[model samples]
Structure formats: structure tokens, C-alpha cells
Target: MQCMNWKLSDIASVLAVEVVGNPEALIQRVITDSRIASTGDLFVALVGERANGHDFIASVIEQGAVALLLTQAPKQPVSVPYLLVEDPVTAMQQLAAAWRLKHQLNPVVLITGSNGKTSVKEMVRAGLSARDGTGVLATQGNLNNHLGVPMTLLSLRDEHASAVIEVGANHVNEIAQLGPLAAPSVAVITSIGRAHVGEFGSLDNIKRGKGEIWQALPATGGVAIVPVVEADSEFDGWSFWQDALAKHHVIAFGDMANLNVNRGWQAWVGVVERQATTEGQLVRLATSDWGEATLELPIAGAHQANNCAAVVAVLLASGLSWQSIQTGLSEAKLPGGRLRLLTPLPDLLIIDDTYNANASSMKAAIGVLMEQSAKTHAFVMGPMGELGDESQALHEQVVDFACEAGVNAFLASGSLSRSLVQRFDVQRPLADLAVASEDAQRLAEALWQVYQQKGSMAVLVKGSRSARMERVVEALVKLASQSAN
Candidate 1:
């Protein structure tokens, strides 16, 4: 964080709050948690579900916070300056919005979509940072909400040439409200899928919510990066993205032939040539300005090819060379809990994609598992949450894929996992039995026994965040380690 040195009067004026402290006092830092407050920090006392920051006013003041941003004035006498507003959170957003504009941070990228938002964000950060003497600021660890966005903006310092902010929304008007705050120079919609369909009601609504990022771009000089889709894709067809973003420059990425580069639109045309010796894929990317190159991504799944293509588009929009993009992507690391490969035992390969799950991601992970040459392939899956009415059918559909994908054995856990087990019929098809357990630990034990009897197999572990499916990975790793010792 660069030295903000914002005056008390400036903060109060931006928030329209009543300032009671020395007006000339400069605040070098903005903090929400009292525990992190220092001498020159402005601590925001927000009201949350578990605890109210208002209760810790005295504690923050003692910790050397020069000023306080509060929704309500404290009951006791306070020595430091305090700005009382109707909502501390909104005030923080306003301050961040003002700060971003004042600094005029160039080439800010705002990324949103149903899936691959984090991966794209990390890729952009990696791609940009790999450039000579480049400093980037991004949302830390999936902090993509209203509060998280503002905190990210506040972290923007003078040295930061670019900022990659991930904006996530489950309902209507959420992303719409966030767009104005960030005011990104470039907006990216990774892909519109059935994620959070329960909250948005349908794919159309999801597209509408995600499109808000494009709407948030500046009137004259903004750019939009979107996935190239088929002519009759479900979400892209109704999105009318070209019409919605008619004013801004649009860059699309996907299949080389399918991408619509006509009518002055730019494209990152690419294809996954083949899977590499590593558990990764080789992609050939070609843009108008930056010529073609075969990039090796140390990540699994064909879906990643498109995700990396989107990153390529973002980088090209930022004026990066093909070589730079390749270097950054090659060095980019996929975060844990998302297609992360682990080897606990000599013959056992664990794909720990347990971060979150939905129908599309589930199928993608399963595809990666089946792509492997392991003699036996197994899946430890949990219920995909927030799928609404289609949750049961989606769960069943995944199991059908498992059965047809040549999965040797599998275990289903969580409330919806029972759907897969109930749908499984050994009499009709596969010789192996599908285990149905209520939780990860139980499934781990059963899976361990299967591995004991079967020997040498690849395991794919995945589920939604609510399922905490990473626990299954932990359990299996522990069992393997004990046996190894």
C-alpha cells in the first residue's frame, strides 16, 4: 500500500460524514479490522453478523488509529477524529472509487463470470508481473465482494501499473453496483454458465448480471474481453454482447474459426494441439498484433485452454508481447483446490479440485481424470450446492458420466451425493460398486480399502465449497502417508 496521506477533511467530504477530529490530519492507511490499526490508519467500524466494529472503538484508538469511520457515533467520549455516516461499508466504497479515479490507474482489468474468474485473475496477474519492472495489485484470496473490492482498490499504490479485480455476484444488481466502483479500463466475462442458477433463476439472468461489468466501463475508452462461443450458444445467443458493448472495443477468445473477428472485432484465436508429457496441455495462440506461439500450461483439463486464451486476450489488450504472455503463463501457478495435482503414494495420483463444484466444472474435472492413462480411475465427489431444483438431476447426470467415462470405482458424499449412489446400478453396467457415504472421512476409509484391493489408480476429488470436499483429499493423503511409513 502506497502512502495515501488522505486528509480528514477529504475523507469526510467524500463520505459526506460529520468529521469531529483535526481536519488536517493525514491518514496514510485505511483499515477495517481494529487489530491491524496503526498510528496513521483510519479504522472503519462496520456492523457484521458475528461482531460489531463499533464495540472496539476504544481498542482501535488505543492501537494508534488516528481516525474512525463509523456508521454510528460511539456512546463514550473519543479523543481521535471520527466520521459518522449512515453506512461504513458504503463509505469505504465511495472512498475507494474516489481514490481509483484520482490516481488514474491505467489498464485496470475487472474479471467476472460463472467459472474460471480466479484462474483468469491469477493468470493476468502472473502475465503482467512477468514483464520487466512491473508491479501489480490484485484481489487477495478471492476477496471479490462489495467489501473485498473496496479493500482491493484501497491497496492500489502509486507504483502499481495495473490492478486485476475479481467481482463475483450470485444475485441481480450485485455486479451492476460493483462496476461503477471499480470503473475498469478493461472488463472480462470468463464464460457464462449455470453457476448460481438458483439465485439468478436462469442462464439469461446470469448473463445479465455478469454483463454489468461491460456497462460499468468508461463511455469512450473501455474494452471488453469475452469468450468466443458458437453461433447458437445458449447464453451468448441471448447476451447480445456485441450490441451491449457496441461503444467499446471487444476482444473475443476461443476456437480459431468460431471466433467472430469480423466488423472490426479483435480475437485471440487458439487451440489445444495436444496434451503434454506433464499433466498439462499445449495451446497455440495467435492474435493480430502478437504473432502465434505454442504455450505449455502446467494445468490439466481442456477447459483451461479457453481460460488461458481469455488471459491472452487480456494481456494483448494490455499491450504485452507474445513472448511475455508465454513466459507469464508458463510461470503462472494454479491455486490449490482447483485442478491441483498431488502425489501421496507411488501409484496414487490425487487431483485436488475440491475448491468448488457445479455441473460444468464437475464434468471438466471428470474429463481430466479420464484423460489420464491410469489403469483405474476413481472420483470422490460431493453435492454441488446452490443448484436449486436442478441439483438432483445435475448430480445424477454426473454419475452417468462417471459410469460411461470408464470410471473404475467412485464415492459420493454430502446431501446430494446420495443421488449418484441411488442412480448407480451395478447389475446394469459397471462391475465395480459405487460407494455412497454421508461425509468425507467415511468415504475416505471406503476408498482406501478399494485402492488396497485394486492397486495403482488415479483419484479425482471435487465438490462445491459447502461440501468441504478437500477433507477427502486430506484423509486419503494421511492414510497414504501412514502406510508409507
Candidate 2:
């Protein structure tokens, strides 16, 4: 298959920027980092907090960049083609939108919500790849935001048969802005929770903000793969998707007990049956259109079942057979730092779910920890940021669940750690439970003492992105390696 080539003139026309060099220079890719800039590439000079892209223009040119996207003109005359705009980030976004509008890729699936967006995107990409093997372009890393979304769309090439775009937002209307640029044919709403309540102000606002992606669907032949939510549940007072469900084709998944198949909403449904397996997640999914199928998922967790079900719904909606969908889902692999296991010592197992956290995610991680068949279990907690007014209450709820769930230790860090320690002590005193310390070294040392005295143990380290709770995990790994020697 041939690569996509965007001429300098065409890109400049789309970006509405001032060109400084050859207009006919061919471009195959748009890059932001100078370290990876190469031939036939358009290097976008983004002015970030730490570094300015213009400072590295000479290096990118040396790496054979065909064009430069910049916010200001170069200090000296340059031979390479360049487009000067008021803001390079905005210019790149505009170009990415124009590129998607021009190419019109098929089966463009958009996944959005508070949590599980990345995992669901990976599953859908794997499922779509099973369709033919031409190629499926998907969002890489955490590029579901405004800048990241555009970068993913710009990466679309000729060989790619389909695209799975992950659209993310912390504030209101962010998805509405990125959705149109993605131009998705199929839309999936993972779940609506208080993931970024601080930015949204309320759980109600988060529901409305995430629901914006449904607006980008095509008039006809559009498909929606959503969770099974009733008026009392996920769809409380949200009538937009209700109308879309009635008009467009639909595939819904969740607890099978909550749905009424006899009510004539025969949209295909994916359900994770009562798992009877010992180790892996046994997913028994039953869909009306595609019939029933059973498969063992690679990862095991209560939340994972819902994500995999959503993946199956997307694949079935894309017209893939049950066999192909199952094949793709079985081979799916999500990003690291989420329920990933790392054994720094022979007796210590780390449950790394440090990607990001909310009340829902925290509880889910705790559930994963409880499922482990280890001699001891400890939780290295961190603050849940951007929770707005409900931060303390929601965090207290997480603490309540951890204590009620029979956890042996709960060591918290961050600004909220002291008060949480008070709360933890009130619920389960230090005499009855393990100690909670403020110092990182003391925290790690205490946890190590408990594990060494109790035999094999599992530690769940998690927090919001800003909290950097991974430091605790790093410290533990270091101590374990040092002590083992």
C-alpha cells in the first residue's frame, strides 16, 4: 500500500498559514519531536512549557524534514519549506481536521468516557484488525485530548483500512470539539463517572460532557455501542442518546439482568456471565444478532469484563463475525501501569494501576487486590485530584470500602494523606491495623517489614496522574533489590 503525501501548498491552504519556502514539497508524516523527525515529514514547532520547538528547527531540518509548522518566523533564512501561523498547535489541529475530512476513512470508531477509554480503544483496534489485516490506525499513548486527537487523525495513512479514535476530555464540550475532527462512524461511550469532577463541577456535568461525542455521528448508517444504562442509572435525564438509539443502529452491553430483550430493543448485547474460572476472566457473552460465545480474557478484573464487552459490541457493529470478534478480543493487550504485575523481589508482587484514578477506579483496583491469593495485601494510596467538592467524601468512601473489604494495610500519601490517616485510624485503628507514616522511606520500610514477617504479599500502588504515586513503587523496588543482595 502507498503512503499519504500532503503537499506543502495543500497543508498551508488548510492551515491558513503564511508559507516561506517551496510549496510543492511532499510530506508523508507530521511530527512534533525533533528527535524523531525524518524525511518527508512536517515538523510542528509547538511552544511548550519546558522547550520551544523553534529551538530545535535546525536539528529537524538536518533530519530531512520536508516542511516546518511554526508560530514565528525563523531567526535566519531557511531553505526548507515552512508555514508560519499564529499558533502551531492550532494550525496542526486545523490541518488534521482537514485531512480527516478529505480522506473520509471507513469504520472510524470513537471511544470516550471517564474511565477505560484506553483499554477499550486497544480492544476495538485489535478487533478491527481481525477484519482484513490491511491496517487499523489507533490513538497512541494518551493522545485522546485536543492536541493528541489531532495528532492521531493526522497519522491516518492510505494503507489503514479503519481507524479507532479515542476522544478524552476533562472539561465540558471538549469531546464536541475533537469528535467532528475524528469523523467517527461508530461511537462507544465506556462509562460516566466522577473521573474529572473538579473540572466538570458535578457528576451530572461529566455525563453531559462525555455525551458530546454522540453528536458527531453520521445521519444515516451510524452505529452506537453503549453500556446498558436505564433512566435511573447512566442515562438519568440524558435524552440525546435515547433518540440516537431509536434512530441509528445500536449495540448495548452490561449486566444482562437490567435489560429487557422482550421490550423490542433488540440491539445486540454483550454480557459477562458469572465467571466460574479460577485464574483468568471467563467472559460468556450473549448477543441477539451474533448469538452466544464464550472466551477467556487476557486480564482478570471486574471492570475489565465491561470493557471487553464494549469491544465485542463495537466489532459486531462493524459487521465482523462472532468468530473474528472473539479472536481479536482474546489477543487484545492494554497499556501498562493498569493492574500490571511487577515482581521486584521473590516474595513481593506489585499491582501497578498508577495510570489514573477516580472513586470507581480506586474501588476496582482494590477488588483486583482482594482477588490475589497472597499472604498479605497492602495499599499505597495517593490523592484523587480534580474531584471538585466531592473529593473528600468520595475518597472517604474509598477508604470505607478498603477497610470493609478486610485489607491488612492502607498507607496513603499526598496532601490528603494526614486527614485520610485520621479517617483510617478512626475506622481501623493502628493497634488493629498496620501503621500509616508520612515519610516515604518510613512508609516503604513499614510495608517491607509487614511483607517479610507475613510471607508472600501483593501491593496495590495507585493514584491520579498528578500524584506520581509510582515513586512509592520505585522506592519499594529499590529496597527489595537492595535487601535481596
Q: Which residue pairs in candidate 2 have backbone atoms (N, alpha carbon, C) closer than 3 angstroms, thus clashing?
A: 198-386
Residue 153 in model 2: lDDT: 88
Off by over 4 Å in 1: 132-134, 260-264, 426-428
Q: Which stretch of 10 consecutive residues in model 2 shows the poorest summed lDDT?
A: 430-439
Please give, for residues 14-57, the per-residue lDDT of candidate 1 as tens digits: 97766786788799888998888788989999888999999999
TM-score to native of every candidate shown: 0.95, 0.92
Largest lDDT belongs to which candidate?
A: 1
lDDT of 2 at 117: 91
Tens-place lDDT digits, model 2, residues 364-415: 8898888887777788888899888889998889988888876778898877
Instruction: Output the number of the TM-score-best candidate.
Output: 1
